[model samples]
Target: MPLSDIVRALNAPATGKRPDFLYRSGLDHPFVAAEGRVFIHYANIRLESKFLPVVDTRSGRTHGHASTIQAFGLSNSVPMSPDAVFVLPTDAEEFVYLDRLVRTLHALNYLTQPVRGNLLLRVHSRHIISVPANHGLAFEEILRPCGLLPEQITLEINTDAVADKEHFIRAVASYRSRGYGIAISHFGRTELDFPFLSQLRPDIVKLDNLLLASGRPLDRIIDNIHELGGRILIEGIDSANLRRNASSLAIDLVQAHAPILRPSGIRIRRNADGGEQLDAAA
Candidate 1:
């Protein structure tokens, strides 16, 4: 089936129910394709999906690609940060809607690439809190129609962003049972939650580089995460020395790009084992 057809079906409204936000305004579809790539038209901006490479430290191969969205003004082509883009949503419903919409955008764009391995994506904390139950259900539905498997996506949630521990744990379990990989981001940014970590047993733990700078007990934390069967991923290795030191710490994966604000024009030099090398700018 054509991608557009699948998107239409996904966006189609149920009987007697109002159309979802994506199909509202009588627009045929909120997505547009250009240069054989997909982009979403959202909130007067054009959002495009960009993947950040997650490299395996041992063999120096790309382990996976984390999906991130790059937004640009529809009229002026000015770039906008993800934070700025997300701030457009006003209420809980809108927050959930926009969160799912951006993930859908990433999923569609990922399908166009010849990349392999899991696609890691960050789920808005607000989106998780807004949904009372059935977390990951709605996004899983969208993924299925896009010809993507739940097992191929890792839903990442920042540690500091989550407010309700119980709901967050439940949501992570929901994603896990549905076959999506779970990644706990910014693990050491705030106070460590060992009990919560034990309960979740996330597939990946993305460490905040601040732990290293602050002279915290990173080795013990890494050990605990490993005991819980979580792979450690240290992001924000901007300097060569930092990258070298991070590799020596037995980190499973390392991302050299900035975690919070990723750069544009990420050129993939070579593709190996679902991992791609980033340009110097990335």
Candidate 2:
């Protein structure tokens, strides 16, 4: 669909109240990409003040008019839009957090997409129990109407959480049954049993940036993973060198934060003179 059509669809009237857990006060400027994606980030804060008197132990002098001020900030920030949204799960407060995330995205006119792409959500294994047994079913009901396929959305499970084989297997099974893609993140850092991972057969495996940065022999690992029928995604690529190296290794996907910030929309081409040309799109 055209971008204008998507914008119009997003602006249409909503039928119900917004989710209660949504941090409406801290909603940031919505960033819309040419691909029709939207992103929003927010922060939550709590402040407290207490009055107290202080005394100097060495000088034996008492002082008054002293006060203590403390501010605790807990951010539940995420990028939301029709094409894609990224969420991080830090606490076991699954229902409230997920409810707010889904409702916020739904309200932002993203749910109107006939075929939304990936909705990447980062979740820990410990909090998996907080998710309902039939959570995948609920997600299917919520996202399928928006034209999102189970494979299009991925739940990024942190490696730390996957140490428990039972929980990991169960969660993987549940999501896979509903057709959602399961990706194991922080691949190299974790001491995971490769044979066990082969058994689980995850759809995607994200290699840690540190391994790539170290200039290690990643090609062998990538080839092995591909042979096992899993696609490899290299994350935390920051420089052109890293991208070049990743491409050399035949990595399937390379994701970086910096490149998106200053998007030139430039398509590189090889000129007839055997030189590279940058063609900036309008």
Candidate 3:
């Protein structure tokens, strides 16, 4: 259901019952939840298979699909309207896996979707600097296989624990030159240096949700970036209530625990035993 429909139903006269929503995840629900507010009613309620659903707050639909592979089919990780995902090399030894993961994400057949959304794959600053200069994809190289343009796929780098600033800037600039969209992750908490932001000129600034959720206003800084035409993404939206609050903000995007997309319409989830089963909803 569209947000406008919900608004209409909310204001409409006392009808027999309320309107239900068919989520992009294929799950049918009564209504969208708000924090401590009215439980907007919906007519049909059916128990469909449940997964981490990503809800695009901007549009009432799923924009991207993701799974919490690390959480044993129990992920609350949401991939919202804009795509963003956290990637980190466990150690120097796991760099291969990280690289492979990036390559695999780029090669996904679903990337061929006509209106390809942001397929964000995040990584730490150390990994950004560590990418063997010759091995990492050039700007167009990143777009070639995926068929997603430079702007579609975001190379999110968390600066929270950068070990080396000079190397980090170099790596970021290298990617920038190549046309890969740059995302500076954990904006409010780490670095918080205006000059660094000015120099880096990140394509996206992902703010820390902890502070946003705490209700501590970072409006002064956030507004400054907005003025400069920087896109803001709010993460750490872990619950329904949190999402309501996020909607109130002017952030460009959001990451939540809700199910966003069910990639390629395949619902075979990885079980704890390391086996895949067809989701009942499927």
lDDT of 2 by residue, 1-282 (tens): 444444334333242222223323333222232334433232342222222222222332332112122223334222122112213344556434544343334323334444334445545454465664654665564443345566656666765435566666776788888887777777777454577677667767778766656667777888878887877775543445645555566666644321111134454544323355566532
Clash count for candidate 3 is 9
User: Which residue runs of candidate 2 sit more than 4 Å off their true CA positions?
Assistant: 1-96, 99-119, 258-282
What TM-score does model 3 achieve against the real structure? 0.55
Candidate achieving the largest lDDT: 1
Show pairs that collide, candidate 3. 19-42, 52-259, 53-258, 53-259, 53-260, 54-258, 54-259, 54-260, 139-178
TM-score between candidate 2 and the true structure: 0.55
Candidate that scores best on TM-score = 1
For every candidate in turn, the CA RMSD to the true structure comes to: 4.8, 18.0, 17.3
> What is candidate 1's lDDT per residue for 1-282, written digit by digit as tens?
566665556556653222254444444467776676788888789888888888888887888888888787888776778889999977887778888888888888777677667888899888888888878777877777788888899999986745689998898888899999999888877778889888888999988767767876677878888999999997654545556766667689876563333245454444323344666432
Residue 157 in model 2: lDDT: 70
Weakest lDDT window of 10 consecutive positions for candidate 1:
15-24
Q: Per-residue CA lDDT of candidate 3, range 1-282, in tens?
A: 333344234233344222111121222332332431122121121111122323466775654432222211113322122212223334643554333333333333333334435556555454565565632354344334334565555566777755676677777777776666677877777446666677677877877756565667766777877766677766544434545655566655655543334544434554423345566332
Relative to the unseen true structure, what is the C-alpha lDDT of residue 167 in candidate 1, on a scale of 0 to 100?
Answer: 91
TM-score of each: 0.85, 0.55, 0.55
Candidate 2 least-lDDT 10 residues? 77-86
For model 2 the local lDDT of residue 233 reads: 71
